[model samples]
Target: MIALLLALGSSLAYGCADFLGGLGARKAHVLRTVLVAAPASLAVELLLWPVLGASFSPSAAGWGVASGAASAAAFALLYQTLAIGPMNVLSPVAALVSAVLPVTVGLLQGEHLGTAGLLGLPLALVAVVLVSAGHGAGGARPSRTALLLAFGAGAAIALQLVFLHQTPPGSGVAPLIVGRAVSSAVTLTAAALLRRRLGPEKPVYAVSAAAGVLDSVANLLFLLAVRSGDLTVVAVITALYPAGTVLLARGVLAERIHRGQVVGLGTAAVAVSLLALT
Candidate 1:
């Protein structure tokens, strides 16, 4: 129960962070948002390290660096998609893919899905399709490019999740530092290559920084949850982050949902519940 609660909290924190991140990217530059967020996130982990008693392991650091690169690309594409696409449609597709990919990875790692997991998996896939099929007020569909980018982001996210889990024991936040540093470098390079303005207004900086803090917290909780339970379970729970993101978009952005999306949400809820009991 504690693990489940932690996973849920992680999902919410991740959702909130992604919401703020998408907003920041839309208002400023996509790479700039990530550049600012990475160091801020790293700072929080650094602050926590003393009390947490971190260790430095080369293997863990390498794993983190690899994961960082994948995650950087993922976030960049995701933010770009969010900037131009309907949040409700893109988020659920990305979330579903992210969940499914890691579960596949876990299975390859010799973790067998129980009966509930097998039943829930198909339902979640159906939810993903229904949510993606939903159109906004004018029946405008997301561009094919945006959907492709979202799928790429999901694949990258799966790589990040798997690599982060492979971090050596007792490394603590050292791996996080390495990972974020690598990610930051990639984001900065991408920003330069794309000729994006890196400087944002003071107010935007606050939003970006807050996004970082929330992300750091979310990642910590995810790691904790993974440590306490099955990786497949934790990954699915964390991928449910779209739930919070969708709610926030509706409330703050006034995004309208389709009837199919409502049904999709119900299916997602049933799927999550079944998976939880697994």
Candidate 2:
């Protein structure tokens, strides 16, 4: 139950962060938005160290670096794919693949789920797809390159989660701190390389910073949840994050919620309830 709650919180935080990051990216280049957000994320993780405590064991450091590198790639690929996208199709594809890969890894590692969990898991995946489905039509179909990028982004995201889960149990938040630090460095390097392409238009700094803070919180929660819970369960629940994003769009941006999303929200609630009861 505790793990379920933590995963839910992580999902909410991630959804909010993505919403803000998307807003910031709209105002400036994706790299420029991340240039602000990545450092801010690292700062938040640093602040958490004193409170949560950390031990940078070699295993933790190695896994942290791996996750961090994967995270940077995921961020770049995901944003670029979305920019070129028919977002509705690509978003769900990425989300589903991210969840599926982690779940597969967990199962291969011999984690088992109960009947309720088995049922709820597929429903949660369906909800992920439905919630991310956009209402509009008539956009250009996604190219083969966009599809490949989306798949790569999803794989990167899954690797990040799996690597974090592989950290030593006693490492606490040390892996997260290390991961954030490495990701920040990578983001800065990418920004530097792309400086010529990144126009002079400034990103919304406040929005980007807020997104970073939330993203850090989300990662922290996910790490904690994975440590305490079955990765298969936690990953699927976290993948339901798009529901929160859709809700925020409705409430904040006054965007229309589609029928698919409404059903998805309901399905997500039911899925969570089933998982909790188990």
Against the true structure, whose TM-score is highest? 2
lDDT of 2 by residue, 19-82 (tens): 9988898899978888888889888888888898899999999999999999989988898888
For candidate 2, the TM-score is 0.96
lDDT winner among the candidates?
2
Model 1: C-alpha RMSD to truth? Answer: 3.0
Query: Local distance difference test, per candidate?
Result: 0.77, 0.90
**lDDT (Cα, 0-100) at 33 in candidate 2:** 86
TM-score of 1: 0.84
Error (Å) of candidate 1 at residue 16 is 0.5
Per-prediction TM-score, please?
A: 0.84, 0.96
Per-residue CA lDDT of model 1 for 1-278, tens digit only, reads 56677877988898799889878877776666777787899899889889776677778789889888988878767767767777657766776788788877777888776799788767866765564443542545778998898888788887888787787657787777788888888877787787635554333788899899999888888777776776777777777676666678889999876687778778878887777777
Relative to the unseen true structure, what is the C-alpha lDDT of residue 134 in candidate 2, on a scale of 0 to 100? 83
Q: Candidate 2, clashing residue pairs?
A: none
